[model samples]
Target chain A: MSTIVKVGMADLKVVEYPDALTTLGLGSCVGICLYDSTTRVTGMAHIMLPSSKAIRKNENVAKFADTAITELIQIMESKGAKKTRFIAKIAGGAQMFAFSSQNDSMKIGERNAEAVRAILKELNIPIKADDTGGNFGRTIEFYSESGKLLIKTAGKGIKEI
Target chain B: MGIEFDRMNNDIIIDVLREIGNIGAGNAATSLAKMIDKKIDMKVPVVKLVDFDEVPEMLGGPENIVCGIFFKLEGDITGSIMFVLDQKSAINLVDLLMPRDNAEFDEFTISALKEIGNILSGSYIASLSGLTNLQIKISVPALAIDMAGAILSVPAIHFGQMSDNVLIIQNEFIEVLEAKSVDGYFFLIPDLDSYEVLLGSLGVTL
Candidate 1:
């Protein structure tokens, strides 16, 4: 039986091959999945903010893109996954509500996606695929065995990357 | 550092705010009753400082589909208010209001529902401002039909950036019309900085 680990909002989890990690109802939040096919180790983070430096709250490391990606990578490596073998697939950075004035805070979805990409680049991880930027919410499931990220939405149906 | 400083620990302040929320919720129920043309009863407003992750469970689970109308509170107190209804209740409401033969949430139905949310939230805020003597203004209301977790995440992200715990005033509205039941929720999230202003105006000081 493949164990399914559920991640909450602003939370993260890791699983091995034949197992999966999933996070549900990602609106402006980004679900970054890092996997190493060799070791079949997978790590997923549901990041709500782009950077922790911009805010006074620094307690939750998994809640920010800057900290989440680095922490996920470290955890995957500790699980016998090689750093160089890591690749990324992300989903669910959506502008859930459209506002007339383009405030920086209101653009959290775009910012989160950008921040994840920037950090992944800095860490030398290639982003294989992403299904993002629409005005709908998504629930993502990441399978370590196949290195596939499955995204499910309401009207948009589902996709695998 | 926001209101999470030592002030939030004061029981007196929390009780005062809870009372304020009760009054506001009462006003909202009245307005909603008028709009729906049915007697709307609201449960006692719950005032609590909840974690960001746990908030989605307030309505349902994170993945539960819901219809939300969002309005940003501006001026003296800045925050957001959302009137959320589950999918079935939302369609039921539209059916009650428009009585279309087919159950479809078209653009017109959505716009109508948004207006209903606008009225309820507006009255809720108006009552709060009136009782507290603060000048509270509201932005245009926006509607989103999505998962409960997704719709609430907008304000959660904005508020969670400052503090892990968000102050929420949640009220449940229910009405049984013709033996059919309908229910929804009203979520009031006051900005971190606004708590101090609100308490100060209410004669409570940290």
Candidate 2:
């Protein structure tokens, strides 16, 4: 039986081939899955906020886009995964409620998606596929062997990338 | 992050907070019971300071599909409030309130749910205000039917930014005749700076 590592909100994990990493209940949070197919190494992050700089508390690298992406890359590289060979598949970042005025905090889903995209661009990781921006929540599982991201929503079944 | 229950060793303070939950939830339950004319039984409310990861499990699980009604709390304390109901409870509530032949969460059903949310939240806040003497304003409620995790993330990110622990007040509603139970959670995620105001208004020493 393959071991499945569970990543919680504001957390991240890295796994090798034949193993999987999963995160549950991503609302406005974005789940970034990076895979280096050459080494069959996968890293997934469940990021809660767009940027760590805005938070005054001690930084949780796994909780923010800017820092979480950086930490995921470092961990993957340490585990024999080449940064240049890394490709990304992202999901979640949903606007779960409708509001009359779209304030900065209220648009966090869009902001999180944008931040992830920008950070991936800076890191030169090409995004292979993405399913984002809706009024729903998602639970995601990333398979390291095939580098497939399974995105599960409530009514909308499952989609693989 | 769980509540610092160890540090909060004062029984009087804990009792005061629990009383707040009792009054607020009691008013909401009474209004809900009056709306449907069905005897609604409510368990003693539970007040907790919980971590974000454990929140979805409170309703069921991260993947459990639920109907969440969300609104921002303004005035004395800035935060968010949500009323979460499962699909069965939502449909049953619509049946009781609207008494319609078809209960498919059509436009009418959705509207009825929102109205119920509005009434419940209004009564909840009103009771708190009456006890604390602090004016609380509630924004128009928005309803979403999806995974519990998705619906709750909005408030967690909005008001729970400063601390990992969130103060949650939860209660259950049950049907008297059928003995059917529906879990309803009331989350009042106050801003980080509002705790002092809340405790001070309640005459609890910080």
Candidate 3:
């Protein structure tokens, strides 16, 4: 039986085949899913911030995109998954609110998306699909069986990537 | 955990924080009363420091749809404030002023909700700064109608930069005319150092 494992905000998990990983209600936060189709091993990270450099109290490595991605990769590799064989699907990172007077924090969604992309490129992991940077929140479920990532929205229809 | 809790667990500090909530939310309820032309009573609910995971649960759940209005706090303090209402309460509150027939919130109802949040929250901040004699200003309020978890993520991420735990102060308003009530929440988050300033101004040591 396939079970969906829930990932909380600033948390991540890796699953074996037939198991799935899910994270709920990602607003400006980004959910990054990495998968290996051959082994059907998958991992998901719900990142709240773009980087971890600014935070002194950041003991949770899953809280930042730059740190979370690397940690997720290592954990997946430890479970017999190859980093070179991994592909990524990403969602969330929406500008939830629009203000005329823009500030650095207001553009966090875009920065998170950009940071994830840069990190993935630096690590040489190709992105298969991405749904980021809009005025919406998302809940994502990633299945290890088929490397399918399902993205659900409040008003928008469900989509698979 | 050690240092943050040390500052919060002090009896005098807790009493002082509760006093701030009383005065701040009281003024907010009064402003809400004037806007709706009804008798409003303030109900102080949960006021404490909570972990990030527990925050959305306080709003019913992560997936519960809510209308949240956010303002960035500046000047003597740095942080953000959010005014949240469940979908039903938002519709009911707007109906009191604009009297909409449709159940769904359109542009007019949405704008009205934002204005209400702006004014109501303005009073809360004014009272806080007035009490502490701190120079506090707020940015233009931003409104979002989305899942409680999604809308709350803005504040969580902003405050989460410091620690996983942040202070939460909730308020409930009762309308005496129809014996009906509306549930509104006020989240007051001050930056780490600013908390020291706030308490110091109020004659407390951190």
- Each model's lDDT comes to 0.82, 0.83, 0.84
For model 2, residues A47-106, the per-residue Cα lDDT tens digits are 888887867753568878988999999999999999999999999889988788776657
Judge candidate 2 at residue B28 and give its lDDT: 91
Considering only N, C-alpha and C atoms within 3 Å, which residue pairs clash in candidate 1?
none
Residue B193 shift from truth in candidate 1, angstroms = 2.9
Query: Taking the tens digit of each residue's C-alpha lDDT, what string does model 3 give over B79-156?
Result: 678898988888888876666567577888789888988898899899999999999988888888887778878878
Q: What ranking emerges by TM-score with the best candidate at the front?
A: 3, 1, 2
Show the lowest summed lDDT stretch of 10 residues, model 1 chain B.
B1-10
Q: How large is the C-alpha RMSD of every model relative to the true structure?
A: 2.4, 3.2, 2.6
Pairs in steric clash, model 2: B1-B51
Candidate 3 Cα errors over 4 Å, as ranges: B1-16, B98-103, B191-193
Point out where model 1 deviates above 4 Å. Answer: B5-13, B95-104, B176-181
Better of 1 and 3 by lDDT: 3
lDDT of 1 at A64: 96
Q: What is the DockQ of each candidate?
A: 0.71, 0.63, 0.65
